[model samples]
Target: MTYPVDLIIVGGGPAGIEAALAASHKGFRFILVEAGEIGASIRRWGHVRMFSPWEHNTSPLGRKTLAVHGHPVPDLAAVPTGAEYLEHYLHPIAQSPELAPSIRTGTRVIAVGRAGIGKSDLIGDPRRADHPFQVTLARAGSSDPVSVVEAPILIDASGVYDQPSPFTEVAVAQECEASVDHYIPDVASQRGRYAGKHTVIVGGGFSAATALRDLLPIAAEVAGTRISWILRNADRKPLTAVRDDVLPERARLVEEINRIATSADVPGLTILRGTRIRSLVQLPIEGGSTDGSGFELSLAGDHAGTLTADHVLALTGYRPDTALLAECQVHLCYASDGLMKLSAALLGAMGDDSAADCMAVPAAGIETLRSPEPNLFVIGNKSYGRFSHYLLRSGIEQVETVFDALPAPVRTAK
Candidate 1:
């Protein structure tokens, strides 16, 4: 007899954990498989602080569940760093008695599909609905499969942190692999490397702003320090809007960046707006020193000029890793944010379809989260696909909406 579980959650982040908690409360058997510890992705940016206060970050279900278990909730008004959010809230919820048994950390989900059915199976096939999902999972350290899980419902809350957007605007033949740095490195620790170097920071997102902030102190201390800020938009600075803002931290973030840019005391700062990196050519250093050469970037568009820098910080943002979903055969909107119907609703609900703008769209309930693959659902940042703006609260709300739509006596034994 196969092990039976009502739902199989493919992640253990805020969305996955919250979904697991809701499933338990609804009296359903579920299992949550995570490739790492709870809040694994959040831990990557432990140095960064979140915009939302504790209240907004914590879901009603998560907070209530934690509170009932004697977990001390942080002040609702307090904004937490990614580390604190993981350590204080996410960890507690994952370790809770209700969820701990169901969550399997250090396990990677390789593929997901319905048992005895291929992606080409016709919708008219009644067996598709009744068929249990076959989820293949592997141990983190090895490629070999440990076990296969069968469940009627599958909630894919896996996030999108691994795939950072490419640096070039168009395809280039140059081999400049060593010239790229996608993530924000702890500049303080490696101050010596960036001290006297000419660094070119790319992208117009919050990550680029944070990278700039990280390098400012180094610039002040080190002599001959030069930095170039490049972006596609020339009209406006990188900012989270202040007007009609629900989160003060977000507004403050924009304010901080603006203040840094305008400050007269901050020298060696150059802003190159409306620029596109057409190609990148690595220039070898005349004298081989510890500093590893530099990159010469070809530019185009409004700001057309070549720039050379010792380091290229490409904070172009991230995209969802939908490679695992290809086998499931779900229809994704190539132009919009989500699956066909979902993409339409998201675009329609929000007048503008920008990733950040779509975050403001009200939740369309659980029905919208479902995919064409019957019981399979996609939530969290992965659901947003190429879109950038995804909030912890929004994902938590999605979990609630999903559980709320659950049918009674859930999955029948096949």
Candidate 2:
């Protein structure tokens, strides 16, 4: 059956935008949908500067596309904050003639599946590709009537930032989630909330490190300000510094944060290693009301005990949301929740000593981008699932790989 378009791309971030550009270049009819504005997730952490320079953050196709439209190129050596990257690169690409016409913002893809078949019907049969994919769409975050669109191919580039991992291995407490800051907080602007307050920070990744780095000066400047850092691992240095790191900014951040974790000399800073939050209760403030004024936490592990704080920073990273593809037969890794073949490739590289650094990860081949269901691809950070090492460069490469493998458009371009 003929579909409305040759392909449907879900997401409007770097990967999705790049895919749309590729689709246009390949002379295919395609639609790119974004749940929010382009680069919405990036805008959330816009204040933080990226470790990778502009060279690695953008795609060659994207740059070429923008250049052809007379858009100025960014300095390749310059590292951009999330805001700058969004404004200068992603936003422009989305608005470029190549992609703008096919893009839809504030439209969420609620579900996707073969139009006439259930997940079990095809069972590895080549006949499966004959059916068009039915994508359910609706206004983002609303319960209005849904619209279904059909496409022969679907590429899910939707990223993971919208879904943050809970602070513990088990389910998160509703009270804890409602009270803590999940995303990296803009400490400078939110000084009124963080200043002179005791904060307990959770997690061991770069997000956590960034929060710690940002809050240190605030703690020093504000009288009675205190910070208690909680790491799930017992390592003295929570962040691993790449040997002879290629990204100087990332290396410096690791070194600085690790130094703070090891030195124990920074006043108003307390590092609690190998700790977890067992329970958290909002305590009543001076007037005997639980208005989010304070928290009493029951801790577990190496530094197990009761602790009190005015704020909690749970920068524990994120995982991909796979619910939208529930009706499709996609193979996901048991551990990472990443596409199976790609996850195996990533895991294999991670096991090797030489591939210790994220930069050393092996490039994803076209085969790794394919799923059990034919003509469906999961690219970008979502393809990495819970893996935290996805570089923007990798997503660009994935877009190229997937498009290259797809068949040329059967009908005239829209």
Candidate 3:
């Protein structure tokens, strides 16, 4: 029930994999914890592909691991889909000898805190109490919950994919009087849910952009389908999209979204932008609605007049399970854009262009994904520091950074 190692990694997504690879090279022992399957986010956003191509998905450390193990590396240019990840990334790495022995799949880290930082324990002792580590469960889905793994340095690669916060649980939604059902993985596959229905979307970020882009195609094909885009500001600007370069991905994404908002029509598309949601009052559930689902939505807008909708898709944005982060005392940045901020300085430490690409998380300061509690690091889009690239590169940066922070590997007596 208590497996111990030098490094305790939480959340086995791209970040955890990269971190595991880095630790392997340094010969540091580690146990990675994940709540669900390796790539949970991909499962949720199955339809969409990354804006960045393949190059952004592999870590410098990962490519090396591939070569060292005689596995052919994936092309940097091929775009990955939800299905592609399992084949190209996850399957190969899991099969590789690089860090497979160290990884404990299906382990979910519940909570982490200070374990130890004493001198005796620092002398290569794994079992010493107060070892400054992390603890995890064998599998949350199992009948009996048991503590399974432990480690000294707990590097958190747990991205915000598993338990997305609901729309009703925030101050903004309450203030704006908006209602949302965030992170609906079943939205697309569960057709007849929003088809031939009037929908209202709220938010000004990528999630909103995603809704706008995807829904347009659906609306054109489906008759009697109408969806509205909403944001706090009438400008209806989407965060610009840019290539994987350093200069202005932020502005570029925002600007591109703006252009999309201008019309939102790309052949067989009937969509408009510049909409906002003021409030929602659900109608009584009735039998005639799609799949016997009923709930007409009343919406107030920023630019346009009030309208009624069959459904409301509030893509406002997402927040970290801050409730969980606060438990571990993982300090979060108070960003002006209403999102968590990571430290940007971490990117500066990357040596070359390749390293820079790995460290280049979208939002600044996510690279500062460290805790005051030594030997703890964060992985995933959270550590991206600025914008959430959600690429394997960010995860790669996480591993490289954490490895850089660890002590030189302990040699076992032959």
Which residues of candidate 3, in runs, are more than 4 Å off?
1-3, 67-71, 115-130, 134-138, 141-145, 163-192, 236-260, 264-282, 286-307, 325-329, 335-367, 384-391, 412-414
Q: Largest lDDT belongs to which candidate?
A: 2
Regions of model 2 farther than 4 Å from truth: 284-290, 352-355, 412-414
Q: How good is model 2 by TM-score?
A: 0.95
Better candidate number, 1 or 2, judged by TM-score: 2
Cα lDDT of candidate 1 equals: 0.79
Residue 81 displacement (Å), model 2: 0.4
Q: Per-residue lDDT tens digits of candidate 1, residues 216-308?
A: 877777888889988787745555454466777676777888887666557778877778888777776556432346888988987787888
Error of 1 at 187 (Å): 3.2
**lDDT agreement of model 2 with the native:** 0.87
Which tens-of-lDDT digit does each residue in 1-414 have in candidate 3? 233477777766677777777777787776666677666666677566555556777777667767777777878777666567656776577567876776676666665544444333334333433545445365657735577455656766666654333333223434223344454334467567777876676666666666666666667778877776655555544453443545343345456557766654643332334443434544444553233133344334435455666666665444455444443444556541112324434334442333244334342332355554455566665553334335565556556655666678565565
Candidate 2, clashing residue pairs? Answer: none
Rate residue 246 of model 3 by lDDT. Answer: 51
What TM-score should be assigned to candidate 3?
0.74
Write candidate 2's Cα lDDT for 1-414 as tens digits: 576688999998888888888999999989999999999989999999999999999888878876988888999999999999998899988998778899989999987889789999978777888888999899989856379889888999999999887776455557656877888888879988888889999998889999999999988888989999999889988898887799999999999998888895897899999899887778876787667778888899998889999998888889999898989989899888889999899888776453278787768798898887988999999999998888899998888888778878776456
**Span of 10 residues, lowest total lDDT, candidate 3:** 336-345
RMSD of 2: 2.0
